[model samples]
Target: MLSPSRRRRRAVGLSLAMAAMSVVVLAGCAPGGSDPGAPQRRSVNTRLADEPITIKLYTETNYTLYEELAHEFQRQHPNVTFEITKERYDVLLQNAPRLMASDNPPDLVRLDVQTDQVKDNLLLDLDPYADAYGWDRFPPTQLAPLRVSESGQRGEGSLYGYGINHSVTGVYFNKELARQIGMNEPPATMGEFEELLQAARDAGLLPIMQANAAGEANMTYQAILNQLLDRQTVEDWIYNVPGATIDVPESVAAARRLQEWAEKGYLNSDANSVDYTSMVGRFAAGEGLFMFLGNWQAAALDSEMEGNVGFFLFPPEDAGRPAIAMSTPGSLVIPAKAENPDAAAYFLNWTLTNSTARQTVADVGGSVPGGDPGRPLPDVAPGSVTEQTQEAFQDVAEGDGAIGFLTNATPGMFQNTLAPQLQLLIGGRTSPEEFAAKLQADYEEDLAS
Candidate 1:
């Protein structure tokens, strides 16, 4: 799972915990909706202490963009430095909770909060900082993941995490392949998108370049979700609303569609065997017409493909439908034991509000800089995929179409359900009925357990 670009090197990983999540369990301590055992509510202070301080970070190994941010922050605050520990994205998924619960946890760690880890009081509640910093002005949906409640539900709860740049997923089409297939612009709808897939196949080019291995097939599942389903339905499933279920017509259609595409040979022949990095390499090297991934690849493809790749939000079912994507700011959490909670919170706030830091996040991370929507956008080359994704994020935000990753319904949900079920569905070993039903069963089992 090496990064596609040395500059970004961040994984457009499935669900990035579970995009770059660090997990803590802080249950039932919601003073202003924060963990009870967490640090006492401090007055909101944006200024860093004018004393020698070292804020430790534990994060995904490829998150060099944040490292760059830390260095720049250090330049601004000579009194502050950082000690960052890096691990593979997958390894962090398995261990962030343990790390967060450790006596000497890093101040900030990259993590996505999952339902299973919602039982402990190990993460700081960020409500005080949010009010102090005017973070309520940010897109309400974008910050939904940061809020954990007394019940440990996702959308409404204490703030547990934040991301500097919000990562957005979409389609990256090879411009030349697109033209060869007679695609003059991004497909206007999923039907047109399918036609282009057929066109690419007829032209003897791989229609889509994606890896089904490592559970990435779920990307396809989630990519088309908003097109066929309502945002509330999706939110219910992801956030653990009682009686929320995935076994529905839209979800089944989505599963069936994924299998149909696979059966039609729109994907690479080695799809099930290929890894995400391989998919990026093939799409960038011109072997495929499109790729379904996030802006995390823009910095890489912008370099490797050299403007040959074009990006579009994965199309909706038809015209006028909002094209939602699964995204949030890269999830970072403050551990309850963090030595410099205020400094960590300040740095997180700085990452969002400071134009310089936002630019660094946008430029280095190839993600939409997370901040007040009114704040002007960071500079991006005109018509670049970077620009497209940033604009797309705005559209999604304005439309309120953003949603969490389906793979993150629970910890190991992907490994236990999505990956295996998707592999089976694509392999024709499972039908849409079976696939969706299995997903519902697993979701219920995990939630109950």
Candidate 2:
């Protein structure tokens, strides 16, 4: 569990000016008269008040959770209804270019946190609305990725999306399995981690469940790169700084390390064909020693493994470097083409602060981005696996560490170009030098276009 002291410290560290702005917004909306029990007058300031509004939302969330939350939201605002649609992560990525070409795109869409399409102009800016509603309560670290430029623009003002919760990637291990293997604790360094993987293999068990079939599995590369490379190197490669290329020594070294892992049989043989959902199930069945996943998997683990999971920050490169993991805010953004931006914003703001909504997210095994809502999720056991998962996230957020996923933080055809190359390198079909050359060529072509 996150220490109460740490939470308070983080809350205090958030910008005082932002906090003051929030107070002003709340005060302006407070009832002008002295009837405390009376329903506060709806602000004339909102643009979507009584108009007929239907918001179309395109998302990657499970349909059941989406429907439940959508229903709860509609119950609060009887006049507002959402036309919700769902798709797999890859489908959304593949179709974004075509969808953006159409004038009638979904009013609300959940985009890949690390894609050029969304950063390029497919998404709408939310800063003006965010400022109006005092949504600045979220700290810079939590909000910056969704707010910054895809080209690595620093502090140039624009907000692309707002995430409902922040997600981090790390290692999920089975504690009982570790104990039975004669290892009593999680590995704390890169070398120890390698040893652990070897131990699992020696015990006739698959060491790691590396999901590599889809581009999504490349997230493991991103997580590992976070430890191996510096933040600026990440930014340069991702945003394609002039005169910089993806074939940089740091990137090549990272690719080579991944290939080495594969060569040593640390990764599962069936990795090339595994889907994320199936990979999670296999891990839950105790088929592997470690599973790399985002915090959102907490809910699935709770239902499938009964809160018996243990997580650790991805081990650092060496003792000198601070342990860090990939994290970004996953948000809801209303499109500029929406028929009801005002109503959509109202609904968005309401959900952001609603304790029940926050609880629903937490109960479903997702982590909330802002302050604690005081209600606990039903399935999340106190002082158990869920608590540890939350603590690990909070620690990364509070520390002065790098933020954003590598692929997400980078720009251009990074995933489409380098990710597949990484897959080939890991499968032993390509050497490290050959992988570097291909990455350089792809990056050059992207720049030419």
Candidate 3:
């Protein structure tokens, strides 16, 4: 899910309360409703003082971080154990709906901002749990994206999930390669960044390292789009705020910039054939000058290159404006059919609020601490890429400029519309105007349906 500000605007507390009541009444009134005498409520011990029990957790992204937190939790409560199954995100996205509805669903699952699963009634309504656990202490903006309306629209109504971290993406540069090309410092404006790209290309080095096969070519396009458009315009488009549209002059120019880079040989000629891992590996091996990707890649780069790697948000279109990067909460949700919802919620809460978990996030997760924006972040390894990423993330996040990912605006956009359209743009098969039109058309189609 893109970060909270771009998520739909939240409904007022009373309105949300009334909506929850209505949804409950409707659920109970359906023909052949759940067994009237069946236990509809289960006891949840927040202290985890119950009999020995193991909670099954299914997750995506940074499983090591989750394992570390789980071990810490176990030290506190010896009787509680976790059975974790980590899967690739593509596989999870493909099967989450069925898995979430199974007779024995995993207690916790990572989920995107998409609301189709919520519409299917596969995820739990977290409002009751939030009340019981006093989760209102979390910043409301952070909680907004996890909410889904009764009518199935996401961003407001009933809270369904919680995130442990916020992620931001930007330019990752090989400092040595940059210095070799005589560009010693990160650019201060988009125009200067373009000049750096040309300089790298002139030196016979890969100016941009991207994996088209992994859909990063589209992300490169978005990074440029972020530089061109203001935050509110992009947010309104991504969140489906009424009257939002993507076929604007700035977007057209952003698309054109991608085509220009492709023509100028700034982007890797074989980008379409490269996988994400290989692309990162090539960059680490000194094959590329810059790679546009998320902070999640920081640990690997830092481990390999040490001080050779540096991160910076793309420069703003206006040199005077502060930079804003696309960001989202790294989120997890409980399935409606989960057998141990309480344990899962406990784990989620512990991971976000516990000091040990926060340290792990700061050190290895390549994301900012999730709970309570006012809380101080644990110090990361000194002079590390993780440290640089954490600083950049905090700057953008607190500056009120972090925006949503365009791919999350509508389901299937990354796979269906953006991936192919971007490939076409890079291949010189589609004009920028045409590319913008296709995107807007798809956006309107999804809205109409």
Candidate 4:
């Protein structure tokens, strides 16, 4: 399934450091473990009477939400302005480190590689601000992805970044297509879900819509593992905890399930040829009964298919188990050498605590509120896909069932390992055990490096 020589080459490519992270490290990310400095705490409460200041923000995501948030922030503090530079995700990844290392670094940036960037001292540790601003008011799980240890170990410790919104992954069903297949409710167990897929196939409808070419196969593969394994086991693997392994029975079983589905013709024969946008478009146009995807596609699907589409967690192995899904927070970071650290921290604090900002996050940002549960829910259109998305996020977040993305298990695992192995599996060139073994090997190699 995985060629050792090729795997070694990919590993070496990563070891050479993704070009952006290869940028010169300065001071070893807060040498000797000293604090970055106190955040601009007074700015949060003090009313700046037209005091002129501009904050530069570099981002590669959530353009609309950030644009809205910036406008609202400027509205409240008339003199505070934003110089936001939006770039493609890859371009930003390659350039952010050098830019952050420059004398006039952007005040804020949406960091995609925290573990790598933090090791270079490119990101400011936001622990002080978290303490001063009561950031713990939000669910602790919501903050886990944003925090990292002094050694750049992720999953638990000092806060490096804060998320504006959170995302969930699961099944997006076309109700109309499901009706044609005689399914009226979301399946509650693995067997029941497979029955639904079979029913759709029997009715001459494509059962699941996925683009293997764009690496969409990993979502389903991961959902299966989430169903079979407990939260802690999966978390251990993803967080790089010592002694963690992905070759366990649960993971092997999960891989087999995906292979079974592929053989049953539940997936499209041409799945390898389609791109992500086209795959979603085909699903929206009613080419398939169910689509395995993340909530990031909710807004667009709502716009395209409206009430025709509904979402649910991928069913657990046992119907009795609590539903678990792949989930994570949006990425935000402050540059270590930012010109206005206090103002940047102030904006971050406002977004997390302010009711108006939370509402915008839920409604305009098309994500659940990134604040505490006690806070009021955003007013979404009744029974809309947006409402369903928020409910899904709430269930997983409050139920302790949410887990970070599988791709996050290693820096480049998604592209270098996962995508190719899954392609081979779906194409009948690799067995399930072989597929799982390859993944475990790559994970171990990355961990060792």
Q: Number of the top candidate by lDDT?
A: 1
Deviating ranges (above 4 Å) for candidate 3: 1-44, 61-64, 71-78
Q: Residue 239, candidate 1: how far off, in angstroms?
A: 1.4
Better of 1 and 3 by lDDT: 1
For 83-189, candidate 3 gives per-residue lDDT tens digits of: 88887565576677778777778888777656666666677777766765667878887887777776656577878888788888898999899998898777989
In order, candidate lDDTs are: 0.77, 0.64, 0.76, 0.76
Instruction: Report residue 301 deviation for candidate 2 (angstroms).
Output: 0.5
Stretches of candidate 4 above 4 Å error?
1-54, 61-64, 74-106
- Candidate 4 per-residue lDDT over residues 1-449, each given as its tens digit: 12333212111111111111111112223423455432232222222334799999888643467667878888878889999898755457668888998988999887644576776677877776665566777778778888778655787767888888888888999999888978888898989999999998998999998888846788989998898888898888888788888888888888888888888999887887776767888998888898898776777678889889898888887877887988788767888788887778778877856668877786666787675555555666666777677678767866788898777777657767888888888888888888888888999887666
lDDT value for model 1? 0.77
TM-score for each of the candidates: 0.86, 0.82, 0.87, 0.82
Using TM-score as the yardstick, the better of models 1 and 4 is: 1
**Which pairs clash in model 2?**
114-408, 162-331, 163-330, 163-331, 164-330, 164-331, 238-410, 238-411
Quote model 2's TM-score.
0.82
Q: What is the lDDT of residue 271 in candidate 1?
A: 85
Error of 1 at 18 (Å): 34
Clashing pairs in 3: 3-328
